[model samples]
Target: SDTLTDQQKKCVAPNVYSLAQAYLNSEQAWPRAIYLGETPIGFIMLDIDPEDIDKKENAYYLWRFMIARDYQGKGYGKKALDLIIDKCKEDQKSVLYTSCDMEEEMPYRFYMNYGFTDTGVFDDDEKVLKLQLI
Candidate 1:
């Protein structure tokens, strides 16, 4: 299937079925996907206070976030971000940060529009951004 390559399909089959259980049971970090009805729309893996990942003072990482091809351009990305931000606010977290490939125009602008400031670049092609919550 175009959604997943053969090797990826095989590798992720079990994890897909146990996604929720794994996410909820995880002791280290949050790795989750957002769904629309029964369809998986996107995934977000984050850490509340990750160690070793260098960041500005008082910031946490929203490590990975990706919307599926069919779900792109539908504003679901913004909604997912809103959900995450709301959760952070509820938990009294002060700052949130993420990194995106600089070559990708949409995500870079999206983060900027949503109030993230470009802090620096890393991984040769990724730009890091930050948002401070009040």
Candidate 2:
């Protein structure tokens, strides 16, 4: 997350920023590395309520996710996201929310391609997307 391109930086915040935020909300923000064998390939952060059996709309969020510059386009992003989706299912979450800038370089299409739909919501200037999970 730290070594992303300038274009990518405009989309996702640095891992340090996400980690510090995670520190502030340790109960809800979950941060982890996307590792390939012994190497760290990416970073992911989730804002989730593991106890949300009722599956509220705000119960789960894909807070931050990024693949390193060199790691992008190598199938790591989708694979890492699958892991995140699995985690949400394990936590009994029925919906996953995420926000992205509306820029062309942003990850709106990627999330949409993965079944996330626009929710007509915005977190500041970022547009929110939702995925309904089975």
Instruction: Report every candidate's CA lDDT.
Output: 0.70, 0.83
lDDT top scorer: 2
TM-score of 1: 0.74
Model 2 agreement with the true structure over 16-122: per-residue lDDT tens digits: 88999899989988999999999998999998763433444545878899988888888899999998888878877778888898888468888888899898978
In the predicted model 1, the residue pairs found to clash are: none
The candidate that wins on TM-score is: 2
